[model samples]
Target chain A: MKPRVALKYLGLTPFAIYVVIFLAIPTILAVGTGLFTADGSFTTENLLGLFAPTVLGTFLSSFWVSAVTAIVGAIIGALVCYAMLGTRTEGALRSIVDSASSVLAQFGGVMLAFAFIAAIGNQGLITVWLQDAFGVNIFENGVWLYQVPGLLPVYLYFQVPLMVITFMPALQGLKPQWAEANATLGGTQLSYWVRIAIPVLAPSFLGSLLLLFANAFSSYATAAALISQGAQIVPLQIRSALVSETVLGRENMAGALALGMVVVMVVVMWGYSALQTRTSRWQR
Target chain B: MTKQTVAQRIGAEPGRITRWVILVVVGLVFAIPIVSMIEFSLSSNNGHGYTLDHWTGLLSPESARTYRTLFQGIGNSFLLAAVTVAIVLVVLLPTMILVHIQFPRLRRVLEFICIIPITVPAIVLVVGLAPVYGIVVRVFGGSIWTLAFAYGITVLPYAYRAIQANLDAVPVITLSEAARSLGASWPVILWRVLLPNLRRGVLAAAFISVAVVLGEFTIASLLNRVNLQTALLQAGQSDPWVAVIFALLALAFAFVLLLIIGRLGSVSRNRSAQ
Candidate 1:
């Protein structure tokens, strides 16, 4: 190669090596292990195991949890974003909310779960207060705090803020001119949103929703902390397979489950990128 | 603007109240749990009244073993964050600037590679890193600090985006050309000229890396390494209130870090505006 060309390639060497060691090779092993047997010969047994009733059930439940959180989070978050948009962009409230959203979005995992337990767990302050003050038992129905039913709200703590962060830029990208133009043409507020605003924001909104789904789907720490036992979601299932001493030879099963998660997230990310590009075109 | 007044005449002002109301409601929804955590952490174990025992216990010598792991995890997480941020800046800033300057066509490829981790969940990344961890342990020995290498990869997507935004904002090519013509070497230009201009982005990236490393649980826990979050988890299993205290502390730490970054960002913006 020419000296200049060689220099350019040399610039890439450190990053390339880092990615290869930490990302590329490990990913290869993850997928590769799933295709081989205990003897190391290639087989599809682990992949097939992903479809067994228990494994499939975990995937389905995980999907349900992700789907519910995504939809609920998107609606609430979009409303929050819309409210913030009505304020001056550089105002204190807007900046505070924006920064808070950024922090809260990353503020998941064990601490988040602990926060929920402290709030609404069986002995949580709110639960105790409600019982003592109003004679209402928060757990009279059952102890849902540690189950999938309870995870929905806990997940939303981060999810709503995350949605706000991702969706705000798109919301800001919307030009006031579009709405003004609609008004000038004798369109009503309802008509403007129905015909123009919703259609314009659809791709970005859908993209953000998919991102939320994938976010909740792959999340493990909060779920792991809350559930404590059994594989309620795909991540927990992977955790069990990896950590459970009794599950002696299930490392490949963990790979298979990991593969399943990758496939779902890959699809979600593809759609997110496609929508992002579409939104950017108009904004630019 | 004219149309905005016309629309307001038709009563868009109602939305102003609705907006405030919605903001208040959303704010409460977000605040309740955090408030509860604080309240629970301070309350007596019997739930009859309040005390600071949990907070004090974290510091008391009686809980030395618990606090030892917690402190070690916190220290390790900070070390990892510093190292990871350094690695990100050292490796990414130059390569990104070089790519933007010399190989514009390679920008997409670089971005794609950085974003690969987004789709690869941490759980999955742990799976992939399992065998790699074996090699890493063998060569480097198993110190929780080596987790920084994995963290550097995980933080790539965010760091790259932050640095890319900074690179795009500054006239890197023009600045470098001007500096070169002034007899500055490449390292001098990068360190003295380019980096100063990219300070906001670098800080943002570092803040994100720190937040991520501090909050990271799965990789550390699964790897049997005692980082802050994992230590909190183990502590929570024994005494839940103590865990909540640590959780609140960590959250406050991240909140303060973000607030500082936010302040710096706006200060820089104001300076540039002037």
Candidate 2:
């Protein structure tokens, strides 16, 4: 390599420094701090405290809600992509819809929270219309909607689009001729879909769903905006541990919790990766 | 044969009905959020009266200060995103080339690092970085800079994966060999031959970064920075209309991003074909 080449390599310094200080160092600190006690002794208090009823409830609720969101989003997204396949309509409408889905996929967190609230809050249009026109009360006497249920619509804001994006390539990979041939063989619609369509779309379906699960599980803003106080998921709890300095004196506790969450995510994502590898065969 | 023939007869007829049903149902389901938002924004006194006070109020001089604040937040967000894209691209491009050149085994490791952030959740990241951020702020004497730091880490997965895919697509060794044979320096091969070829990935990554920055509410709000998402949240607390308008604007931002991505993808495809 010449001197100029070496000089260009030096350009890599800014990025290298930024990543170290911001990402690596801080993450290490969070784990280190959360795992150690005030007396400089290693303790599992924070990680154990993570199992407290309040924290556990939030985790369980988030798990179920996120699971539903991922599955539903993937299914719907796959169906949407399937419907769009081979359609002759090509213009602004198609592009607009595609764009809309893409935007919604990335538009989660706090913005999604606000969007859902505005759309479904107490005095929200949907809320009011449902009450006056149909005499239905979504949250009449229960804290259900605002808790885990309310998080669903917000989750969908991103989940559906994520599914659409992830599943599109998979859909395209499935040869239409296979379906045509099956149809010509006098196969029933149900059998054709169950035997052929499902098998072909299975890998994409599984991969997309897993990806969606990871997306929703790691979500913090949507839950925070929806049920700020009561339901404390891992992320919110982690944020709280950092902020409430008076109570959370042991930084190690925070670190332990952070490390635990990272571990769980790694496991989940490992499964996702395995699914992706298995589904690679479906990709044309 | 009869069973197969019977199944085929049904399959031969397109499930147009099911297709239409799925289209209408899913389309309506997806449209609900946007429709509800528009209704809320257009409603007066929180939908009690059908008036455009919320929309009209936005234009009034009284709302000017708030608009200024909102615009400032947006500006800060865009600046953060711009810086983030530049930082991420610089880091991702060279690292990608080096990994392909020297450490093929490290590819998965690097990818794991990138994807780890995705699974960590924004809240965890903010929590983990808060102490680090505080120290940096105290030492460096700046708070807004924290947003860039946080955004950079959170979006690393997106940037890395995109660039990695693109790197895999192009003939990396061929390009490097071509450069080497021509007396081109490694830097020239990396920058001129490699970086230019990685344009599509860069664009996609940039868009993801933009989306991440613009829509980043947790980290910004947690740190009490007045980014667009935080401002929107605060506005909603005071008056629901503020949240509604913010949501509309957010949708607009998302729409623009989508259009840009679509255009970029098409252009890249066209170029690749050529």
Candidate 3:
């Protein structure tokens, strides 16, 4: 019986070994890369690079971008969910928004950045059209579409939809019985939401907010495609460190930068999971 | 009871006008860029006036040279998507099924392992992968297809969730027990009994793998690979319109795929509950 049970776990070996080699080891090496020199001698010098102004600036911008998008997206997406709450389960609008949000949420990257470029880049469609019709230079402020602020609109494209996708379940999980109960106590429509739904949804909302923050923070291809000139975010910082020739013997900067990113992601995801547990409590 | 009692089932249908107002406003925000992409792609040049030349240029002789790399990237991405999907179906699928029926205790650990990819961003993963690829190159050749190994990890959190949701919905244990009572072999049971039942989740996992692989850029680009995104970026440098056109096309393809996925999600949940 013991041998048979051991044999049952044979199926896990392929996946276990795969992640260990590709994921687990690489994660360890990624964090550890900053602590060693080129000749493989252990040192802590390269990690100080994480504190350098440029990296800090990138992290600052990353936080600002993520926080803004997460907040804005959470608001818009929560409103979208509130809008969707009225529609029947099998309604066309509900499913369209459901599927559309799913698609938009996953579909951001180079393609999305290009779509925005075609819309608002220096010679973009809207840029050209607006110039021709109204004689207004939308890019008079230095082609913001290609800069850090530019990521907001593009990031929101995915962020809002992702908010809708993740937060909708929490919205839908609102039991009908609660509303009826609130009404039996002579509570108004506004009162029910103020008292019951808001409190119950606070954790889920915060949880989704954290998720969106991590998402926007870690997103690379969209930012990489847009901000072609400099490292304006954490992911882009890692990119430049990976490719630039002028790291000045600091090969571990990219490692340190990646380590920084991993730390943020770990903290944010940990909070998200904790909130998720709290959220799921009411869900069941 | 005020007028609220009549609509209490869904809790006050929120004023239909209000609902439409919010949805339409948000919908248009999402739609504007897509419309611009189409309009931009249709334009002949950066100047005024429009022509089909840009669209027709795909068949032109010069475009063949211009887009040679783009074609190679698309091909490589498709191959990567196929291999990645194969990995999910073959390795992840069986392990999940086995864990569900045989070793239920490992489910949480397996879930954690699968989800670990989400916490480590692709950029950070690439930082770690640079060295692993060294070993990967030594063991497997430096072919672009091997990049699927990393993609397999990236797509894990997605594929696992899709399959596991279905696994939870299905009565895998009951079916396997009955099959065993009928004297069926484990291989036969998995092949004949389980795969058919998992069609929705399995197909969803495969579609998700394809969608993710097509959009992947960070790993392939950092690792010096040629895939759809890297190819698109390069092509955009020379001919931006064609690049936008292809981006629009990829976007449309993904939209349709996810629409189906969305349907699959509800269909499975409803069927299993009943």
Of the native A-B interface contacts, what share survives in model 1?
A: 0.76
Off by over 4 Å in 1: A245-251, B1-14, B59-66, B267-274
Instruction: Write the residue-wise lDDT of candidate 1 on A1-284 in tens digits.
Output: 99978987898898888889998998877767778765688888788888888889999999999999999999999999888765677799988998899889988999999888888988877888799899999788789888888889999988999999889888777677777788788888787778887888899999999999999999999999899899989999888887862362444778788888888999999999999999887677
TM-score for chain B of each model, two decimals: 0.92, 0.86, 0.94
Q: DockQ for all models, in order?
A: 0.68, 0.46, 0.71
- A25-83, model 2: which lDDT tens digit per residue? 77777666766676777777777866767667767866787789998888778778876
**In model 3, which residue pairs have backbone atoms overlapping below 3 Å?**
none
By TM-score, rank the candidates, best first.
3, 1, 2
Ranking of models by DockQ = 3, 1, 2
Tens digits of per-residue lDDT for model 2, B188-250: 887788778888888888987887788888888877788877777666677777777877887
| Model 2 stretches astray by more than 4 angstroms | A1-16, A88-97, A180-187, A245-253, B1-14, B46-53, B59-62, B66-69, B101-105, B172-196, B270-274
Residues A1-284, candidate 3, lDDT per residue (tens digit)? 69877787676799889989899999988888888876789887778878888778889999999999999999999999998875678888888888888889987778989889888888777898899999999888788888899999999999999999899889888887788778788888888888889999999999999999999999999998887867888898788888872553587778888888999999999999999999998887
lDDT of 3 by residue, B23-140 (tens): 9999997898999888888887746688788888888888778789998999999999999998998888988998888778988989999999999989999998998999899998
Q: Estimated TM-score per prediction?
A: 0.95, 0.87, 0.96
